[model samples]
Target: MKDKIQSFFHLEEHGTNIQTEIIAGITTFVTIAYILVVNPSILGDGGMDPGAVFTATAVTAAFGTCLMALSTNYPFILAPGMGLNAFMIYTVVLSMGYTWEVALAAFFVEGLIFLVIALTNIREVVLDAIPLSLKFAITAGIGLFITLIGLKNAGIVVDSPSTLITIFPFHSSMQDGSFATGGISALLGLVGIVITALLMIHNVKGNILLGILITWALGLVCQLAGVYVPDPAAGYGSLIPDFSRGLSVPSMALTFMKMDFSQVFSVGFATVVIAYLFTNISETFGALVGSASKAGVLQEDGKFPRFKNALVAQSVGVLTAAVTGTSATTSVVECAAGIAAGGKTGLTSLVTGIMFLISLLLSPIFLAIPSFATAPALVIVGFLMISSLLAIDFSDMSEAMPAFICLFTIPFTYSIVEGMALGFISYVVINTLGGTERRKKVSVAMYVIALLFVAKYFFV
Candidate 1:
């Protein structure tokens, strides 16, 4: 069995043993397992059933990660994306006043579009058209975005009435012995960050996973000591739950096969579908390239060797998400956590998928992990991803400016699509004005993309 498994994954060629791969997989799983709870909570705010969304989230993650492992042979995992889910619930359903069923239909149609594009040469063409500097910028931009998300989740950052944003009063309140204002959660997150950073500095193999477990243990201890007060305003203060009640099976009746496609082909809905498609494309490309580069799996040309297979897997995952009544699924940047832990092949993803499957029965345990505990892992992963900025050529103004825009705008605007759009548009405009040769170097597809994005921004 060991030999067969080794041969199947080319584990030896990848310089990884089964044990390392399994550990990497577990590490990756722990870092991303928060999605099981977070996704359901977010979608439930849009009037979907939390129990059904929970089941869908787990099932889609397992299915997508397994397909990515078998088809692309990469360590990346796919799940319902955080930003995309927000767009679905806040923008599509709430603001636009569309039913969740209609949004699912839009997602399904977008998935089909992705499927067709991935199967063709368009995927490679779009990838090739992107400049190397922009790729690195996208990677770094995603890192900053992830870090911002971690800070928000940990309650270390909050809205400021005076300045646009400001630090939470965790420290000030703690100094005054006040725990009512989310200081406890912030303190727990800080401890987790310190523990994880220390373990990483010491070169521990499973530092991330170990840090999460340790933080969770501390939360349990605090609960027993009666210091872990649940803050309803913090959104994730209920980290400890009664385990004696045992597991309750989740209901899938509300969300399973709930897509409504009546308005899919209409002009108005087509715009929404196109928006979803573009966001998914940009996200998948950034995540795959970033994680693969970290894993040392990119070719000399800085492209994934199995790009088409990865896209196919991602598209299938999105399609499955729509069918299961969730938002679109895409490659997660958290896969970098596994790569940083020395995962180099698909076996890591296979293990992660299996763990997600098992999590279906252990939902309560996984769900009880508060965002503050996982926030530390995300901050560390973000730092690892931002390290790729070293590859960008800062000397060239043309490349540096667009790259800088891409990197800074991602976290600032809090939208990956907007960052990528601004970057691509600037790249095309700057190069076009540079010289005829430079303009000629830009691909026709890029010019078209720039125009489409401009239209989407102004007209759509």
Candidate 2:
């Protein structure tokens, strides 16, 4: 049985063993498990039922990761991405005043488009057209964006009327003995970060997961002792999650195949679909390349072997997520944690997928973990991502300028699509102005994409 399993995954060929792959799988699952809580909460805020969203998030993640393992044999996992979910709920549903049904239709349409692109050579062309510097910048930009999200969740940063944003009053609140005004949560976040960092520094396996659990336990103790006070502004009203029932069966009634396609051809709808498509493509590309590079699986020509299979799996995952009533699922950068832990085959993804399925029965316990406890992991992951910036060639202004714009604009504009558009446009214009050789380097597709982005920004 063991030999057959090894031969199936070609574990020996990849210089990995079953034990290491299993540990890597667990590590990957731990790093990304927070999505089981976070995605549901975010989607529920947009008028979907929390229970339904919870079930959908888990099912989609498991289905997507399993497809990745089986089809691509790559140790990558998929989930409803953090930014894409926010875009679905905040931008598409709330701000646009469209019903959740309409937003879901857009997601479904976007997924189909992605599938079409993935099956054609267009996907490969797009991936290859992107400059290496810009790719690194996008990865780093996502890191900063994730870290910023963590800071906001922990209440370490707060809205300011005069300055736009300011630090929370941790010191003043401590002096005045006011625990609710961001002091306690800020302190707790600090403790979580310190503990997680220390564990990671010591090479402890599953440090991210362990840190979150330990911090959650501490929060529970504080709640029981009457010291942990929740603040409404920070998106927490209680440290404890409402237990709907000890165990509940997964439900797909609210969101399954509920898309409303009547408004699909409208300009507003088109813009939403385009945004989702662009974001998913760029984000998945960055994640796959970055994680593969970390795993030492990227080929000498800077291409990923079996890249087409990975793309197809992710596209299928996105399609599944839409039908499951969630946002588009994409490859996650956190899969790098598993690779760093020595995962080299699909077995690792298989284990992670099984864990996600198991989480369906443990939603209540996982949801009980307060947002602040998970904030530390995001911040740490962001720091790890920014390390890629060291590889960029700062001396080349043409490359550096575009990379810098891509890196800073993501966090500044708070939209991944916008950052990528600006970066692509700047890269083409700057390189064209440099010389004939540089102009030749910019592909026609890049020019077309830049123009489309410009049109979207102004007209759409």
Candidate 3:
């Protein structure tokens, strides 16, 4: 069995053993498992059953991850994207007054469009057309973006009206001897970051995975000692796994096969579909670029191997998501956590996919992993990704400026596609105007993409 597994996944060629791959997979799974709980809660506001959304979300994620493994043999994880879900619920359903069913139909049509595009050379060409500097910028940008995500999740950072962002109020809250909910969690997050950093400095194996478990264990101990109080109202709930609800999988009856295509030809629906397509394609491209770069899998031309296969898997995953009654599915940024842990081949993704399947019965245990625990891992991974910036040729402002824009916009705007759009636009405009020689270097694909982005911003 071991030999067959190694042969199929090319584990030896990838310089990863089964044990390492499994550990990487588990780390990725735990890091991203929060989506199971969060997705349902977000979608439920549109009057969809939260329980059904949970099941559908898990199912779509498993399908996408496994398909990615089988097709590309790269350790990329997929799920219902956070931003896409919010767009569907808030912008499409609630704000636009469209029923949740109509929104699903829009996503369904987007999936069909994705399927057609994946069958062609367009997607791969666009990915290859991205300048090498911008590719590195995307990596660093995503790194900073996810790092900010870690900070927000751990409560280490909070919104500020005065400055736009501020550190958690540890000083003032501690003086009163009654720590605020966010303050305590933020404090724990800082400690976790230190502990994880120490583990890394010591060259400890599985340092990230260990950091998460240790942080969660400490939170549990603090709860016992009453230093960390659970404030359910503030989104800080009990650390203990609640098995009172039983382990039976939630039924998907409420949302299964619920798509309504009645508004498919309407103008508003076309806008919705275009928005989904733009975001989905751009986000998938950005994620693939970052993950492949981190895994050392990108070819010299800045394209990854088996590119079409990966897109096919992503498109199929989106179709599965729409059919299962959820939002569009795409490659997630959390796969970097596994690559940081030494995952190189598809086996890692296979393990993550299996875990998502297992979570069907063990939801309580997986869902109980607090965001603060995973925050440390994400923070560390973010640093590793940002190191790509050191490779850029900052001496050339033409390249450096666009790279800088992409790197800054990703974290600040909190959208990978958004960052990529502005970066591409800036890259094309700058390089085209640099000189006649530089204009000759810009590919037709780059020009076309820049025009599309401009049109998207202006018309759409």
- The residue-by-residue lDDT of candidate 1 on 1-460, one tens digit each, is 9999999999999899999999889889877876775677568768999778888999999999999999977899999986677668766786566899999999999999999989998776655777888878876877787778777777778888898778777667778765643676778888999999999899775576677768878887886787887766646456675466588757788999999988775554665686687667867887888798898888897766888899999999999999988889999987887887888899999999999888888767655677777777768867877887999989988889999998898788776566777888999999899889877868897787778767766654
Question: Compared with the true structure, what per-residue lDDT tens digits does model 2 show for residues 80-180?
Answer: 98778767875577666688889889888888888888889888776677788887887788778777777777777877899887878777787877766
**Number of backbone collisions per candidate:** 0, 0, 0
Runs in model 2 deviating more than 4 A are 1-23, 44-49, 86-103, 171-178, 231-234, 241-244, 260-263, 266-275, 289-305, 336-344
* Global lDDT scores for all candidate models: 0.81, 0.82, 0.82
Error of 2 at 342 (Å): 5.3
Highest-scoring model, TM-score: 2
Off by over 4 Å in 1: 1-51, 69-77, 80-107, 171-178, 233-236, 243-245, 254-307, 326-349
Q: Give candidate 2's TM-score.
A: 0.86
Q: Please give me the total number of clashing residue pairs in predicted model 1.
A: 0
Residue pairs with backbone overlap in model 2: none
Model 2 C-alpha lDDT versus the unseen true structure: 0.82
Show pairs that collide, candidate 1. Answer: none
List runs of model 3 lying over 4 Å from the truth. Answer: 1-54, 68-114, 175-180, 201-207, 251-307, 322-352, 415-418, 456-460
